[model samples]
Target chain A: MEQARPQVDLEAALAASERRFRLLADQAPVIIWRAGPDKQCDWFNKPWLDFTGRTLEQELGYGWAEGIHPDDHARCLEIYTTAFAARERFTMDYRLRRHDGVYRWIRDNGAPYYDDDGSFLGYFGSGIDVTDHVETELSLRRALSQADQYDQQQKQAQWRQEMLIHELNHRVKNTLATIQSIAMQSFRAGVDVRSGLAKFEGRLVTLSRAHDVLTQSNWLAAPLDEIVQSGIEPFRTPEDDAFTIEGPPVCLPPKMALSLAMGIHELCTNALRFGALSARGGTVRIDWQVTGDGEGEQLELTWREAGGPPVHSPGQRGFGTRLIESGLAREFGGKVTLDFAPGGLVCRVHAPLPAEEPPLVGGLVVPHH
Target chain B: MGRRVLVVEDESLVALLLEDMLLELGFTVVDVASRLETGMSAAEQAAFDVAVLDVNLGGETRSFPIADLLRRRGIPFVFATGHDPSSLERTYPDAPVVRKPFLRGDLRNALARALAG
Candidate 1:
């Protein structure tokens, strides 16, 4: 009878302990759930019911799966079932609908439940809303990718700038070499030193003027008219019409323009000393035109003088003549003829015109001056 | 006669300067070609003991092709360039280089080094 009394008290105590546990779980902040050994949900805490806004009858069995986001349904079930079969603890994240019809990210921690006798009961789990945490992680990933893209762009720009500087350095060195060559020619042996110095200064000015035209166009291409005007600008006298220039709008590449300017300067200097420009009534006519098209394009320029002293071929080819012959020919990649007719000197130039602008190599961009 | 040499330069004034330098150094100028096409033919047909090549021609053209031709014929050559000297080392590692605006002695030394190697 004493043992029977203790057993009855024990049963009552066990029932009370279970009631306390259910009360605590219902009042807890987190959503708690329990499933039966048959893999069907049997009970949900008050918080869980409130979160889903569903009655216990509607939420029995697999009804809870209806609240899971469609995208996460398969994955969530796979994880849950896999852990259930193994009777092991598991953690997972999935989006679950709230009472307000908003999907909230939930981090659920689940563990297999066991009775004191080592008999398997089912599974119990708790979930917390972690939508803010998930969103912050996603935004952080996007920001990191954007920063990577900006870093790549900055690197490319820096590389381009370095290439431009390298190209600029190369060009400056070449210009220096050109100047050195001019100096050598101006001060060569067997020439009058004083006159040579004067010629050097004149040629320097001529080179500078050509550079001025090129600078305006960023050393890309220059107009034929601009080059001619720049060449003849220094030699213009009170007689503005002493030189009659006529030419169409012809654009020449940097190398061609430079050579043409130098050639024109040489012809003008000769005319100023011995050609038509030497006399009051003398007049020099400069005419140029583009002929043909495409691959056969050519630049035909003629320099003719009238009303000058009777022309005569020089006994020896001077520096000016040699430069006009060899330099112009090479630069033009065509013929340059000086005809010392009885009337005046006629310089004729024929050269092929490139079809398009040559592509700049290495650093293609020209840095602003 | 001094060592016969060919000059492949695009710029006329620069060509003249090179010719003058070769003459002053007591080398006979075999021929001078101002364009890459003419340069190619000269490299193939011209009879010369050595050659001086300008690295960059008029536009995008480079003298590397001519350099290769000279190499095949076992002819020694020197490269003159306005570009950084190290730039040429990548393509022609063993070739001698003379920077632009160079002294007469620089040309002579480069030529000597090319011929010796």
Candidate 2:
């Protein structure tokens, strides 16, 4: 009778402990689940059933697998089965279908549950939705990549700016050297120092005028007529029919325009001193045309003076003469002929026309074929 | 007759001044070339004791190639540039460089040093 009484008390105590466990599991906020040794879900807390909207019977055993996303089912089952067989702790992330027919990301953490006697009972696992967290991480990664690309573009722009500045500095120094050379040559060649200074200033002004035209064209080609006009306009007067210029529309490269402008300036200076423009009824005629076809195309220009003092070839060649003759010839890769006929000082230039659409100074940005 | 010198400068006024300076220094100016191709041809065809080369030609061409040809012909040449000397030293370590707008005495000294070498 005494042994029977103790057995009854033990049964009651076990029942009370089980009741307490059920109450605690039901009230838990997390989706708690228990799987048997066979790696099949045996029991789920109230939260789990509420999340999946499934009956206890439908959620038991392998029936719970229906809630897992088709894409994640195999991997999810593999992780659970492997952990169960080894009786090890495991954690994984997967997509699971909710009550609203939406697949949400969840992180599941499982551990081997043990009995009081140190024997493995089953796996106890808990899962939490991590959909928002995962999406935030993906967007952050994309933003970081975009920022990296923007940084690379900024660096490239900075490098280009530095290169342009360096080129500008080199050009400025070169211009200074050119000015020094002009001053030195002028002073050495001049019989009168003041006259040399005037000539030097005139040459500098001519170069400046050419630069202005080039700048207006964005350092591209300059019109030949505009260049001639710029050089001769200053020397024209109301009473003088001294200049007669006629030329077809011809676009000259920057270097060519600059050299030609200087050449024309020299011609005008000479005309004023001893050529056609020196006399009252004197006149100078300038004409040019494009000749030939295809690859043999050439630009032919003529400067003729008449109705002035009887033209005489000078015994000595001055800077003006040398610049107009040899300078233009070398620059254009052409021939220049000077004919000091008793009538007038006649000059003719034959040069190859530049290839169609020659590249401008800043046109190096385009890749060549 | 004086020592004949070749001047390879792209700028006309600069070349003219150089010619005058060379004449003043008792050197006969042989030829002046304003482009790389012209300079190369002049170097091959002309008779000159020494050459003055502008390092940068401001376009796609540089005078280094001409300098290389001069080297092969056993001709002494000096570099003139508006750039920093150290930048050019790596390529032409032994070549003397005269900065642009140089004094006549400086150019003469550089040329003399080049000839002596």
Candidate 3:
């Protein structure tokens, strides 16, 4: 009768221990599960059932596999099975689908469990939601890659700017040499030193004006009318009819624009000094037209002066005359004619125009009247 | 009669200025070429004691090809440029270089040294 009493006490003790385990498992924050020796889940804690929004019946005995993402199911099962057979501890990360249709990343750790007698008692595992950590890591990687691309782009921009500065230095030196040459030539001609200085300054200003126009156009090309207007602006009088310029919309390349500006400036300076512009009623008419087709196309420009005193060719050719005639002609790869008529002076230039580039949106085109 | 010289400068005003300087120095300019191609042809056809080549023509073409041609013909030449002399010397170590906007004396000395060498 006493042995029977001890047996009942022992049974009661076992039931109490079981209840304690259940209570602890339910209160734990982690999701816990147990799989049988056959490697099929047989039990899950209250947290696991609540996390999956599944009833205990739906979660027990491999039923939980239904909540695993399809892409991760095969791999997860393989790892679990391999670890189970070896009775070894294992860790894995996989996506688990919740009842709300949202997939969350889960880090699962599993280890073999054994009884006091050293007999295997299936596997005990714990899982924690690691979705936030994984997502943060991925976003960090993306941000790092974007930063690397921006760094590369900045390096390239710096290299390009350095090259541009080098080229600009070279051009500046060359321009200084050109100015020196002009001064030297003017002085060597034995002309009035003061007059020569004035001429030099005038030419320099003309070059600067051309540079401004080219800079505004990104150094590619400049409009013909703009070049003429800038060159003749200083010479324009309030009378408004003393000078007339007519031309089709023409884009001159940088070199052509600069040379043409200098040439026009020389002509204007001459007119203001001794030619048509020197007199009150004199008029200067500048016109140009594009002729021919295909390879034979040419720009024909004429500078005509009238209503001034009788014109006569100078006995001695000055820098201005040479620039307007030979210098401009050579630059354009064309011919220039300068005629001193009894009524006025006439200058004509014929040259090939560069092939037109496709016009961009809001391109620089002066509308013809 | 002075020794004939060829001037290869792309800038017209600079070329004219150089021509005047050469004439004042008792050297006759045989021809002035403002481009590499023309300079090359002139170097081949013209008869001159020496040549003055601009190191760079219009920031695109170099006068090295003309210099090479002049070298082949056993003609002495000097580089006239706005670039640093050391840079030119690195390329043409044996040739003389005269910087732009040089004084008449400097040019005369350079030409003399080129002729003597």
Candidate 4:
């Protein structure tokens, strides 16, 4: 009875120990293994064999190299060789062939083992798949570099184009000035229609003055001060302080500058030939003011002639009259009234200045960095 | 010293015209030079009763530098320009200006006004 009791207790202890080891290996996610000296595979868990899809005998010894990528075999072998010689741990990340013949990145870790006497014996290891993570990291780096290169190229192209445009504008301005100078000299050679020569020179001068404003403002909108001054430039005389100029500090857009220039030119020509600007001591007062209406915006301008010959409407709408009315009103989204006031000619122009915007040419917004 | 005047005009013809007009008005001509650089240089180095300047010279439209020099030297100058007066008036409110192709009397009047101011 006593002998039978001892046998039962031993059997119970053995069963409990076996169950604990099995639970540890089966429940754990990591694939684990053990081996003997001479790099022999003495033991491996179910997961190690399952991940490799190989039988125990097929994976014995260095047969596990079959799962290692062909390219990684030499480097991995060198690492293991060093470890075995030094009796140290061997751990690395490498591509391992999967069950389906595809290569996947795996976290491979192992440590050389020794007997109780410290002599080299064998090794054990764990592995985990990391193929997707490594691939994503590599692809992201490539995409980032490509974007950087494309942005750099676009910026360089934009700079070159701007320089070319500025150069072209400068050359055009110079040519126009030269033409005006030659024409004036030729007109002096023989003054047939002094009026006609004056008119031609006036136009060229207007264009030249406008170009000056554009250049000074750096191809941006022309200031109202500049436009008014430039318009009256060719007509100002020593004691002929005929035009009293006034306006708020406003920047006229390019389109508005052209139309307003032509209008001012007509006014100047008319003033010289007929209006208050025609006679000695004749004066023209010019002014503009801005005010916001219920709708959006409004500009009121007054061109009043103080001293001149008897005022009379030409009894016909010549280019000058129509120009002052229609041209000034066109696209102004506003109105204008020219009163041939018997005392002096008075022109009242009303326009709704458009809202200002950030400077940009064409569809591009200065191109983000 | 009769009203001595310095004429700084780029065009030789314009300069001669101004000189003749000044002589006729009993004013002695002190000097005449083209370009603002030389004009300012002359203004700095010489003493003058008054200066006459052509506003536009080889693309530079601003006479502020010459004006500054004259202002510092306490000498009055008038602008002789074919262009308009608004530009100059904005910069120099009290400075007198005489447009080109003028009557002999117009320059005389402008010179008198500038010297008086």
Number of the top candidate by lDDT? 1
Question: How does candidate 2 fare on TM-score?
Answer: 0.76
Instruction: Please list the residue runs of candidate 4 whose C-alpha ends up more than 4 Å from where it truly belongs after superposition.
Output: A1-151, A154-194, A293-295, A324-326, A357-369, B1-117
Per-residue accuracy of model 1 over B27-114 as CA lDDT, tens digit each: 9999988778888999999999999999887546789999999999999999998877887898898789999987999999999999
Tell me the fnat of candidate 1. Answer: 0.61
Estimate, for each residue in A55-137, the C-alpha lDDT of model 1 and write its tens digit. 99888899999999999999999999999999989999999999999999999999989899999999999999899999999
Q: Candidate 4 lDDT, tens digit per residue, B5-74?
A: 8877654434545665677788998877655767788889877899888775433334568878898888
* Model 2 lDDT per residue over A1-369, tens place: 977998999999999998998899888777889987777789999988988988989989988889999998999889888878888899998887889999888888999988899887889999888999988988999999999999999997787676666656666777787688668756774359998898788888888888888778776678989898877876789775578888889887776677678778888888889988888888889999999887777889898999979988988776665665545677557787778988999888787776754442222332123
Give the interface RMSD values of the models in order. Answer: 2.0, 2.4, 6.0, 16.4
lDDT of each: 0.85, 0.82, 0.82, 0.71
lDDT of 3 by residue, A113-221 (tens): 9999999989999999999998999899999999999999999668666656655666777788768766775566567989888888888888888889988997668
Candidate 4 is graded, for docking, as: incorrect
In candidate 2 chain A, where is summed lDDT lowest over 10 consecutive residues? A360-369
Residue-by-residue lDDT tens digits, candidate 4, A1-369: 987998999999889887888678756787777767776677767777788888878888888887888889889888877876677787877887767788888876888766689877778777778788888888888988898888989988888577456444434443443343334433543467776576666766775787678667765578877887888888888664777888888877654564566567768888888889889888889999988964666778888897899899877654344444533454445577788999888888887776773343422234233
Writing each residue's lDDT as its tens digit, candidate 3 over B1-117 gives 999999998777677678888999999989888778889999999999999998877645689999999999999999987667897788788788887666788899889988998
Worst 10-residue lDDT window for candidate 3 chain A reads: A360-369
Q: How good is the docking of model 1, as DockQ?
A: 0.58
Give the least accurate 10-residue stretch of model 1 chain A, judged by summed lDDT.
A360-369
- Residue A58 local lDDT, model 1: 80
lDDT order of candidates, top first: 1, 3, 2, 4
Model 4 CA lDDT for position A283 = 89
lDDT of 3 at A10: 93
Q: Each prediction's DockQ?
A: 0.58, 0.49, 0.31, 0.01
Q: What DockQ was computed for model 4?
A: 0.01
